[model samples]
Target: MADVVRPSDRFRQGMATRRRVLGDAHVDRASGSATPFDQPFQEMITEGAWGTVWSRPGISPRERSMITIALLAALGHDEEVAMHVRATVNTGASREDITEALMHVAVYAGVPAANRAFKIAKHVFDRIDAGETGGGSHD
Candidate 1:
C-alpha cells in the first residue's frame, strides 16, 4: 500500500511551490477568487498538480517551462500560454526559446495551433516588454 498525504499538508506545500514558480501576486488572486463551489477544484490543483508534479525534482523549472509552453501551444490553451510566457522570467526560458518551441508545435501539432500560439506569445512578449505582465498560470 502506498502512503497517504494529508490534504492540508499538500495544500500548504503546493501553495508555497506555486507561489515560487508562478509568483505571489498570481497565486494570491487565484486564492482570493475561490468560491465555495470552486474551492475543491482549487484544492485539487494546489495539491495535485502544483504540489505533486511541479515539485518533483526530475526536471528543472526551465525545462518544465519549455515543455509547458510547447504543450499549451500545441493544445491551443491560449490563456495558459500567455501566463507561462510571463512566467518565463522565473523559469529562465527566454523569448527565443519559446519561439523555437513554437516551431516544433508548428511541425507536430499543426500550423494553425502554432500560428495562434505565436500570436498569443507575441501578445505576452509585448506585455513583458512593456512591463505589463499578468497572472502566473491559468491551468
Candidate 2:
C-alpha cells in the first residue's frame, strides 16, 4: 500500500506560488500526470524551489523570471527555457527583459546557448502573440 503524505505549510504556499506563476491549467496537468516515481521529485521542487526561493521577498517575480530564463538558457535546458518563456506572461517579465537577459547569457554563458534560447523564446513569443497561451504579451 502507498503512504499518503500530508502537505506541509511550505508545500501549500509553494503550490499557490507555482499556480500563480505557471497558471492553474499547467499545474493541474502536471499534478494529474504525476506518477509514484516522480511524485517525490515534484513535491521537492514545490517546497524547495517555489516555496523557499520564489516565495522570498528580496526579488520580484519579474526579476526571478528573468534570472530563471537566463540560467535555463545557460544550462541548455531547452524545454525549461521555453516553459519559463511562456511563464513571463504571469511573471511580468517583458519581451525586452528576456532579450536583455539572453544578451547577457550570450556574453557570460556563451553565444551558442543564447542563440538556442533566443529561438525557443521566439517560438513562445509567437504563441503569445497568437493568443494561444491565454495571458497577454507584456511586449
Candidate 3:
C-alpha cells in the first residue's frame, strides 16, 4: 500500500499563523483557489515561511510588519505592500511607521519604488476607511 500524506503540525501552525497575519477572508480565498498543481507549493510556504519563520519569536509582529512593508516596497511588490500595510493594524504599526519605512525604501531602494509604495499605501488606507477589506488585486 502507498503511504498517505498528511498535514504536519508545522503546516497546521503555519495555517493558523497565516490566518492571523493575513486574515481569514484573504486566506480563505487563497485556500479556495488551491489546485492539485499548486498544493505542494502552498503547503511548502505554509509550513516553511509562515509556520516556521513568521511564527518565530524574538521580533514582535510590529517589527516584522515594518520589515515586511519595507522589503515588499523595495521589491516593488505593490499589492503585497498594501496587504502588509493593512496587517499593520493587527501588528500595532502606525501610519507613521509605514511612512518611515517607505522613507527608508526611497533612500535605500529608490525614489520610484518609494513613491509607488506611498501611493499604494494611501489607496489601502483609503479603502480601509471606506469600510472595505484591504483584499484584492496584487497588480
Judge candidate 2 at residue 100 and give its lDDT: 99
Task: Point to the candidate with the largest lDDT.
Answer: 2
Which ranges in model 1 have alpha carbons more than 4 Å from their true place? 1-7, 135-138
lDDT of each: 0.84, 0.89, 0.86
TM-scores for candidates 1 onward, in order: 0.89, 0.92, 0.91
User: Least accurate stretch of 10 residues (summed lDDT) in model 1?
Assistant: 130-139
Candidate achieving higher lDDT, 1 or 2: 2
lDDT of 3 by residue, 1-139 (tens): 9999888999999999888888888888787788998878888889997899889999988888899899999998887898888888777899999999999999999999999999999999998899888466321
lDDT of 1 by residue, 1-139 (tens): 9999556877888888888878888888887888988888889998998888788889888888889889998998888888888888888898898889999999999999999999988888887789885664445
**Candidate with more favorable, higher TM-score: 1 or 3:** 3
Best by TM-score: 2
